[model samples]
Target: MTDSCIQKQLTEPGQEGPVTVSISRQVMPGCETAYEAWISGVIEAASSYPGHQGSNVLRPSASTQNRYVLIYRFDSYENCQNWESSALRGQWLDKLDGLVQGDAEVQRGTGLEFWFELPELPVNKHPSPHKMALVLISVVYVLVISLNLLLAPILVDSGLWLKSAVIVILQVLLMTYLVMPRVTRLLRSWLFK
Candidate 1:
């Protein structure tokens, strides 16, 4: 299964900032199969929704029975709200009525907080500062060197400030929407360890 978010340009005119919604739930004993099926159906239904980027599921281990974390991504808050208010999602939740132990806790956020989140963990648990700095430096180094090499000639006639601004904006966008998520996911074992 693909574990990465779909690579799409998440920023466009009139679009709200990208959003991440997390749903944490506890399944009743012997309801894992039913819960899994319900989750699949919801994901399938969500895929047809506007601005749906992707999703990630973190199933509980033997040591963490009955717990599951579902992370969904949308290009904007409005789009995510649309999904949340949709009848299809309502139907899915209805199916879970007796199968789940209690009300699922939901959390939502935008910006770097979404990308930096660790699967199955609380938001307050972040990577160490040293690991974060290393990742940031690595990503920025590669982006700056590659982008500068490619854009320098094109922006040669432009003012230095203009060139710098363009590069900075591009870097921020790529880091926020693209590079950081992939890198963090790839290095999760090391970073989290």
Candidate 2:
């Protein structure tokens, strides 16, 4: 962790929704095992905190240039901030001394922003709002049309609100776990250009 990282997280107020923090660090030679143990402990500690959704560890890969990425999520920004500023987290950061080559780079994202983030790329800049809106609109339009066609028969007898709710829940789930990730990767060049 860096002073700037801590300062920014402490001073800035985040939006009220799910928030994710990506911590990227390059481990010192031969310190991989220790770094792994440290990360496990910290993640375990984090899971005990309020609003902890879960965490995902991206181990060093060829494309990532051997940098470990720890991505953790909280149900809301306030809870995430609480865990980030906790003494337990500080103690975990203290143990990072000499284990890593440099101060970890941290990136925070909420809502749709995380969809635009590329873990392999360190560039913090996000696609412009118009571009994101365009992509989202295109994807959502297709989803809506396809879903309505597919579910019309099944939901024909259902009330309007119930049918709408089903479509929205499915859309959200598919967008979050399926479509967005693949679409983002496919359009990375244009999106990040």
Q: Pick the candidate with the highest lDDT.
A: 2
- Supply candidate 1's per-residue lDDT for 100: 88
Q: Write the per-residue lDDT of candidate 1 for residues 1-193, one digit (tens) a residue.
A: 2434333435554465788888888988888999898898899999999999898788986523447888898988888989999998988888998788877777787655565675456545667667777888888999999999999889989998999999999998898668887887788888777
After TM-score superposition, the amount by which residue 66's alpha carbon in candidate 2 deviates from its true location, in angstroms, is 1.3
User: What TM-score number comes out for model 1?
Assistant: 0.60
Q: Write the per-residue lDDT of candidate 2 for residues 100-130, one digit (tens) a residue.
A: 9977889988767777777877657678777
| CA lDDT of each prediction against the hidden true structure | 0.81, 0.88
* C-alpha lDDT of residue 9 in model 2: 41
RMSD to true structure for each model, in Å: 10.7, 6.1
TM-scores of the candidates are 0.60, 0.74
